[model samples]
Target: MPTALAIAAFSPSVLLDVATTVRAADLRDWDIRTVPATSSPQVFGDLADGAVDAALTSPDNVLLYAGPADNPLGRMLDLVVPVTVDRGLDLSLWARPGLGALVDLDAPVLAVDVTASGYALAAFALLAQRGWTRDRLNVVSLGATPKRRAALIAGACDLTILNAGNELLAHAQGATRIASVDELGPYLGSVLCRSAHLDGERAGGVAAVGQALTATASEILAGEHDDLVTASAQRLLGLAPALADAYLTVLRSPAAGLVGDGRADPAAVRTLVDLRGASDLRRGVDVLSAAGIH
Candidate 1:
């Protein structure tokens, strides 16, 4: 029997992409697992508790978990980021049907995770760019993308950031994307985080995982797995064929999709630091190199 490789993540596409890549790599002996973590904290918790081997999370989480401060776990994790799944910002803030203008958004009561969540960090950055702050808006601590989507439709919140195939569904529902993380400088969106617990020959699996992810990314960038990817979008995200195609378009774009070579670039690292507004966290080339982000 093969060892189970479990990964905690948020986006449906990342899970699907990893599965596709793993299959393509002929790693039939490995039993892959994915848990859609309610929030970044949950993802980290799962990792710490030995419930999951690795995670697909942001660089901010990497820093905080491996840090000197601001970690929810209150301890440092020896995380190795060998590859980045999505190179671009897949997050987009969607508004209800009547909300066509930015100024029109009021109280806002935006539906997203707590201040520590990845969505909250990116949302805060966008809001700050618009001369707004987190204190000004009421952000609810919601978990899971489906709940957020339902909350938006039910008028529970004024806005929320949707990623991967979620944005496609939001578009189909007549909700408009008022803002995007794309406007912000290089967001290091999602990367492959591996546990340092594995030793000897077991540790080699991390490199295999990275190579599989890189292969998948190359297929996505080259549009080689359109049917498979589109089918995945439909099944995993409940997206229609047209919406799946739209998601595929984003996935295939050289600017908006996965990292082709599996290495996390330094510029994206700098952007992630700026996006989190954590300049004092001892971030730079050296830190990234130490974290296996290069």
Candidate 2:
């Protein structure tokens, strides 16, 4: 029997589908353990330390890898494939209605998950789209969606970036959606990858998992697995009747759901690269590869 491996995920929706397929195919028979987590940094750390075999992480991790700043692990890790287009709460720029456009927020405090989180990247992209430079905004690291929302409501921030169920709630509460990361286009949200150990020793299993994710995404896009999607929403997202339905609606849409090529959508790839380039997260290194049906 092979040893089990750890797999990190942020949301229940992402893990539910992959977990279901892994179980259904008896992936455990090959001696693999799946450990799901919410934090990307933790997952990345686990991957570097061999605590986890692979992870589903944002493209920002790629920026962390190919960077001008020093990364923890030098050159052992690489993204084997991008399994899904995670348009979920891709981060929306919001203000307290009548605050004028986002570009005018010169020195405005903007709430975010973290400086390195995907939400932050989206926020930067929003600023760029609004024709504002980095010096124009006072970026505040409020952490998590709940915190960001609280900051927004308590007037701790003039503007904020939110993701996931939080975005829906914010919109319902009258937070004006000045921009959506999706509007700028597709940026890489999550990916299927592993550390040097699994990348070398258990490459086949890793690829198998990626393949399963690709197939599941295809099924979702084709409406062949509506039950799986709904169940995933109910189980993982804890969404009520209305929100869950809406999420499913977006998930099934062409602009949001899985691409037909069993890889990332090209627009999303370009969006990510374009956004990253606009932001000062990296100096000049092209962080991600173009969309390919791996």
Candidate 3:
């Protein structure tokens, strides 16, 4: 019988490379279930309650949920990141059509998964670069990237950060990208996380999944999986050929895409901490070490 594992995330497309590799390996028969999440809190809550085995989530979420700070769940949960995922899949702030330039929108509404998370901080920083502060706009807590994209196209939110192919879809719908997360310095977009309270068998499963994902990332960076990745992007993200190729370009970028080694970069973690203004909350905790990422 195959071991079943449920992994939650905003977009399952991010797991395309590893899922195919894992299936091909067949070293361990594993039923990897991809559970779609609408928000970080739902994912983390599922993780905390053991409804899900792991989550591909924002690294800053690991920092906040595991640290002394209050997360959206209202209480801290013991979480560990077994592996760092992508750098940033073109994470950027975008505006609806007819809004040109950062200054063109008058009192624009900003949509975010949550105001206190990493992406939101990046959005605020991008806006700050143009002298637009948080108070300058109406910020609403719209869940996840897809929801935000829908809101953006529906004219519900004038500005929001999107990535992982959501931005491409938004652009296809006539949205304009204002600034990339690259403008914010070193950034880690995602990590594979799970509760630290797993049993022996479950822990081993998580480790195996992490190793497989890491190997897949290494292969991707080495240019060994270009065709597979491109096809996966097209199938998983519903992206056209050109956009799928563009996403592949991002996945292959060492600067802004997949972390080939599965190791967390201290500088990137620091970037997330600095952006969230929670350096003080992270005191005495070796963020990477605590997350089992040496």
Candidate 4:
């Protein structure tokens, strides 16, 4: 049976990396049923329930679900990360183009789902850096990057964070990036994770996918095969030529890309934990290791 892979964002940041890595592994025959990125609950919950073999999601989801305090599902299931997708934070805070400066940004609304999303936590940190409180902007709970992107473009919300193909699309639409998570330093973005309950063929499939993802990260970091990268972004994320180009430019840069060895940076993971106000969670390191990254 083909391994079922659910993606939270389903963008090139993921699709291209998977495709390149799988191709490098010569696992072309590997059948993977792709479920589009949706709300984290629906996707990660499926993994927790064993409905899906594995998924690509933020480390925040993994930690939140693994933790004792906020795990809504009651019983905590081990979310094993087989590979790390992005080592550095690949997010940008964008707003309507008309604003002259960050001060002119009277953005009364910040469109992001604060419910169980690490990006939302990072958004709050960015706001603090700018001397603004969470109350400064009315946070709108919206799932999926495209929905958030649309909200920012339509001025439904004055600001939101975007990454990968979504960031390029937002930029092309005149949503200017005012601040980036990169500036904040070391934010773990995404990972390929699975439940500890997986075994037999399921476990083998997870390993294969992890190997492919690791290979994909290596190729991306090497920054070769521009055409392949661009095509994958366009096909998977439905980005226009210009947007695809922009995505590639960023992907090839040293600022951000895949985590070449699938090992999650401890500092980066720690940064996320601190941002989420879960610093006292001592077992976090063990949890991060269970995800196959440390």
The most accurate candidate by lDDT is: 3
TM-score of 3: 0.93
Residue lDDT tens for model 4, 1-294: 334543334343544354545474455535666666667776667887777777777887778777655655655666677777774435878876564666765655777755557888778788789887887777888877777888888878888887867777777788888788877777778888788787667767767777776776677668756677777777877887777777766655555766777787887887777777765455545667655543
Among residues 3 or more apart in sequence or in different chains, the pairs in candidate 4 whose N, CA or C atoms overlap within 3 Å are 81-291
Give the per-residue lDDT digits (tens) of candidate 2, residues 1-294: 655655665544443364456356645544555565645566666776777766665666655654534444444244444355455434578885446765455587777666666667778777777776667778877655656776786677878876555556566666777787677765556667665455555666665666666666666667666655666666665656576666666666655544444455556656665655544433212324432344
- Writing each residue's lDDT as its tens digit, candidate 1 over 1-294 gives 777777776766543454545464466656667777788778877776667777777766776676655577776666667777675435788886567566766667788865676567778778778876877888787876767877777777788887767777777777778788777766666777765665534446555666677777786676577777778878877888888788788776666677777666777777766666655556333435453333
- The superposed Cα distance between candidate 2 and the true structure at residue 112, in angstroms, equals 2.5
Instruction: Put down candidate 3 lDDT per residue, 1-294, tens digits, no spaces.
Output: 788888888875655445546455643566778888988888888999999998888888887787754678888887777888888888999998777676766788999998877788889999998899888988899988888999999989899999999999999999998899988888889888888887768877777788778778887787776677777878878889999888888888777888877877778877887887764545313545444354
Query: All models: lDDT?
Result: 0.69, 0.60, 0.80, 0.70
- Residue 244 in candidate 3 has what lDDT? 85
Estimate candidate 2's alpha-carbon lDDT, on a 0 to 1 scale.
0.60
TM-score of predicted structure 2: 0.75
Worst 10 residues of 2 by lDDT: 283-292
Please say which candidate is ahead in lDDT: 3 or 4.
3
Give lDDT for model 4.
Answer: 0.70
Candidate 4 worst ten-residue window by lDDT: 1-10
Model 1 TM-score, 2 decimals: 0.89
- Candidate 3 vs candidate 4: the TM-score winner is 3
Error of 3 at 60 (Å): 0.4
